[model samples]
Target: MLAFDISGSMLKIANDFLSTKASCNILLYQGDCTQLFPLRSNSLEGILSISVIQWLSEDSQIESFFKECYRCLQMNSTAVFQFYPNSPEHADQFVTVANTTGFHSYLIMDMPHKTPQ
Candidate 1:
């Protein structure tokens, strides 16, 4: 598993937790997520990113991140990211990036309401 984070402290915590709790191996990379990863092409089976991609400050970076993810994932693989976009445009940007990078992207929305009889 590859866990990418920008904060060194968070990475340390993740490494510590994985060392003690996880049976499988995990590689931790602390830096900009858009940069080229030190991994081979089509090397990863899946990616799990939580509340990270929204921090990307530019479209180029977002595009680069998606491209890198695409390059690293095997065919028919998946990537799960939890991002809270500031607006519809932000969400659309993510989808555009993913689609341009060859990922079939979909958004799942949760709506909760009390129904009146």
Candidate 2:
């Protein structure tokens, strides 16, 4: 497994926490999500992002990020991201960009009672 973050300090904290557990298969690295990932094309089975995509403030950056994700993932693979959008429009923008980047995108709301803002 591979994990990356733009913050080295965050990676250090993660590394420290992982060290307390049994042997882990995860490889931690410092990387920017908006830039090219340090991985070969179609090399990854899937990717996961937790509260990360919200940081991409520009459409170009989002497009680049999605493009890289699509390039890295194998055919029929998935990339799941959990993010808090500032508004409904922001969330829609993400899905639109992902779809434009050739991904069959879907938006799932965990809280059905609350409307997405």
Residue range 1-117, candidate 2, lDDT tens digits: 987899999999999999998989899999888999888999999989898889999999999999999999999998998998888889999999999999999999776356678
In terms of TM-score, the best-performing candidate is: 2
lDDT of 1 at 19: 79
Off by over 4 Å in 2: 112-117
Backbone clashes, candidate 1: 0
CA RMSD of all predictions: 3.5, 2.7
Error of 2 at 83 (Å): 0.5
How displaced is residue 42 in candidate 1, in Å? 0.4
The TM-scores of all predictions, comma-separated, are 0.86, 0.92
Q: Which stretches of candidate 1 lie over 4 Å from their true place?
A: 22-24, 111-117
